[model samples]
Target: MASEWVVAKKCLYLHLPLALTSGGSFLYMEQYIVSARKYRPSTFASVVGQQALTGTLKNAIATDRLAHAYLFCGSRGVGKTSCARIFAKTINCTARTPQGEACNQCDSCRQFNENRSMNIIELDAASNNGVDDIRQLVDQVMVPPSVGRYRVFIIDEVHMLSQSAFNAFLKTLEEPPSYVVFILATTEKHKIIPTILSRCQIYDFNRISIADMVKHMQAVAANEGIETEPAALNVIARKADGAMRDALSIFDQVAASSRGKITYQATIENLNVLDQSYYNRLVDAFVAQDVATSLLIYKEIREKGFDSQFFINGLGLYLRDLMVAANPATLTLLEATDDVRQQMAERAAKLHPTFLYKAMSLCNDADFNFRQASNKQFLIELTLIKLCQLLSPSPDESGSDEGQMRPLESFTTSSPAPHPIDIPAPQPAPAAAPTKAPTPAAPAAVHAPVQPVAPPPAATAYSLGGLSLRSRGASAAKAPTEPSPAAPAPVELHRSKPYSDADVERAWGTVRRSFPAEPMLTGIIEAAVPARKDGDSFELAVGTPMQADIVGKQLATINRTLRNLLENDSVELTVAVCEGEIPPAFWTDAQVLDHIVANHPAVGQLINKYKLRLD
Candidate 1:
């Protein structure tokens, strides 16, 4: 007996430790739960950032007004399937309370918790999106629930359902059995056909608010006994963009990266986020018109592995926030911490409204063109330079009027008071004596016979109209001189008579055909009537200064063309603004020119001479 007891003691010592070690390993394994499943909302009340959706579902359950087919559409991770499962449990719970909540103490709820529920079915349509899979689902829908009152079928990613599968499932989806309930969830509702959309009650889920996400994350951190900063959690919440599941996933990543204590710096570094300080400094530089500082901030961000495109896009969004904060009505939309919000408000106040508008426009343009730009860094730098220019006063208006005016020093001064000088008037010179004298025997001979020299035939003067020409010696010697070899014979000059009303009409018709399709010129041409003609010079009356200027500028070109057409180089053109019976095409270049000069003097001056009409 003593020998048996010694052997048993040795065996017990060895076996006891092995059994204890196995139990210790099991205990350690049991301590951890993945953040995803550990934080999944177990009850309707436990869900985060979906109070309205959950409340509506609860009210429906309470009123016993359940739809046969329901559709939930939203971005991913915004509580689609979780709501479906909760709805399934609430409706089929054996011990459902009067308030329409499932009692966890019941056998049916326990089966659901254990993943053994017979009435609820989930199908991932992304992988099983075929006619056969849908047919199988239809077949299952025919069967009654064995353990619950209603059979719930949850189809996830319902948008992925094949066209044939959707068609095959449509009849049953529209008219399922009284005991059947179908819940479809998808991120893209547009992909789902209109027929399918028409048969279901759609619920659109919104992105979770940052405050709500942070509150839930804080609750999670508290439950896990992890330390976190509110600022750090706020960053994670914003990064999640309104999806609670995404927030929790990010929380897990950040918590792991930080070894359970998340600081703002750790969160930013782990996420590879450009620091807010950089954005703040950039904005400060923009406010102060500091291009060098803005460029330096951009360089630092680039060095930190942030893409220039993303940096520009983020800067655009930041400016947009500043714009929103500039107004009290839009301040609510700015999603930042209180401290950051106050800083934005202060910065917004310092910026001019027009400057902000122009800055925002520049940033947005840079973001849009960043992708196509060959030298993207230059594009960003140019955008900063433009933003800086916006803050400075325009060069045209930067100085006072007095500073722009010409100074007295620029004027040329006259030489000091020139003295008067005395001068004498010149006397006329005496006439010279004749070189030869003739002796006459009789008075008739001395007087040279006193015979009148008849004027030459070429020297005889005749006037055709207002113009006349005479030979050079005709006035002095009263006789024509022989034509010189070097000089051509002079032709008589004649004045042109003024055109009659009929003649004026004929000339305007000629002008009209000259400019067939130019409306402004055509209109003016049609409105013009000959006012007067003086010695080959014609004048046309226009109703306004604009028309006068137009015709006046075109006068030279028109005159040249008219002279070539009419074989008359002496023809001249004149335009004058007058008050008279306005023609049908009464708008003259004068009125148009006046308007153009009024609105755009530079354009007017570039195109034609402008004269302001005085009323």
Candidate 2:
């Protein structure tokens, strides 16, 4: 075996200058190469995402426990071939280190580096996988290294070998020449013969994590003098789906097209990937139960050329990532930059886990049915509507057994405060007109009714749309008669405590449902998210100025109902085009510093003294 190997080596490198030179002075210029090939790992430590396998291989070499045959199995682009090459090179290093890594300084290492080494052999089993090919490989195993300690044979895509090929090579693989070592690599291990598997040591490689991929891409970009945002790198990393080579390829494409810097927008554009902003806005709409906005966002996505199924899948993944980011223990599973993670955490903070789970289930179901449905657009729209509904408050609590039943009309929602059902019936006014207050005797008359009106529960407020059932004379609305001048004074009705944002939304939704005459307005109100800026001053975000004007016209009516339900007379409303956010182009800065400075006296004085132009 050793004599044959020496003879092959002597013939292999008998010619030098692996690089072709003209006139023995000028070398041929290397053509442009992709980053994936340029940055291929030459050492185990340099291999991108297989620490366990690499570590085990090094330890085996260090302990002098070399296996006769080894199998490297994993998905494509996961460094299987790279690891095999590195292992073969390390074993043949003439001056190997104590840590069991190649020195790359000896004659054997130099020949391998120049791709002229006869000791290390590589075969592409994917192409040459017939019985004849296997017979030839078996014959070659008899040879040993010329200067190195052993002969290494690396057969990549070994699963492609035919049954006959397997049978032909089985004996040689099971018991190779004493100076020979064999390495088999495949993306599919089950396809390989069981007899072959039994003889080789198997190393399973894992998909490279997004965090590792991002760090590696960052290093490559830095070395290439390309400036890339962490967010952009993270996007490319996630798109690579846990393959370092794929990530590098994507990074190369984006860097080439982007203008000097690789921004997140540039990557999304280049990859044709849906922007994260869309998902962010979609989640916002879901939380608000804004069906109109959700539908519109989906339409926008469609207009952008994204497939419905793709959108559904992306939404499912986005929710999954948000779910992972929501918990500290699972946050490590989120594949994003700290900035993106923080944004996701903020969004997640607003969502209950139940809502997130249900939202994900809706998206998954939509994805499952997307291809089967004839009208994919409607299917997706319906799915989004259902998702919005999951976060919406029920119009009436009558569905629940806990809520007492009453005649629907017996509950009056015509006014801000609930009206007495016992009052004499009267013809109703037009829907646009304000409801009139009942006469003074209405309260006394209410005490005479045999029907019931339940008192409000603690920490709970009931809307007039849903009946508050109570039996007549069940409670004392009667003037206390000075508390009978004996027992302690009667308990006053509980005052309304300040409500949180959730409470405000719930109350507002009920109020909207109460006005069944204006279905469109009710929907608009449902879509708008109301936020409290100061005591009693709530800002409601609308999609358009027209919506703002419409809501503005109802400002008095809405404030009255909200104040009555919330029991805060100071309750106020401000309808604006959402969170004071607008397109930057709209301002174009002639929005005017004086507009802001008018509120700040000190800043106004400074501006006036400087004679600064408003523009």
lDDT to native, each model: 0.65, 0.67
Query: Which clashing pairs does model 2 show?
Result: 452-470, 452-471, 453-469, 453-470, 454-469, 454-470
Candidate 1 residue spans exceeding 4 A from truth:
1-31, 97-99, 336-343, 395-615
- Report the C-alpha lDDT of model 1 over 1-615, residue by residue, as the tens digit: 565455556657665422223223322223655576688887788878788888899899888899999999999888888889989988888777766678877878888888899889999999999999999999999999888789999999999999999999999998999999999999999999999999999999887778777788888899998999988988898898878888888899999889879999999998877777787788777755577998988888999899998888888887888888877788878876666667788777655455566678898999889889999999999998777655332211211111111110111111121121222233332233111111112221112211111211222332222111111111111111122233332232333444443444444445544432233443455545443346666555444444454455445445543443344556665664443333324433444443443455464333311111111
What TM-score do all the candidates reach, one by one? Answer: 0.60, 0.63
lDDT of 1 at 315: 85
Query: Clashes in model 1: which pairs?
Result: 208-242, 545-590, 546-589, 546-590, 546-591, 547-589, 547-590, 547-591
RMSD of 2: 21.0
- Tell me the lDDT of model 1 at 338: 64
lDDT of 2 by residue, 1-615 (tens): 565445445545684323323223333244446799889988888898788889999998877799999999988889998888888888888688776788888888788888898988888998999999888887788776678888899998998988888888888887788888899999998888788889999999998987788888888888988898888888898889888889999988998899669999999999999998999899878765678999999999999999989999999999998888878788878877676778788777656565677789999999888889999999999999887766332222111110111111111133232221333334444344432211122232222212211223324644432321211122222111111232222233434568766567666756665533332234346444455656767666444333344455455456655764676656666664422333333432222222233234465333323222221
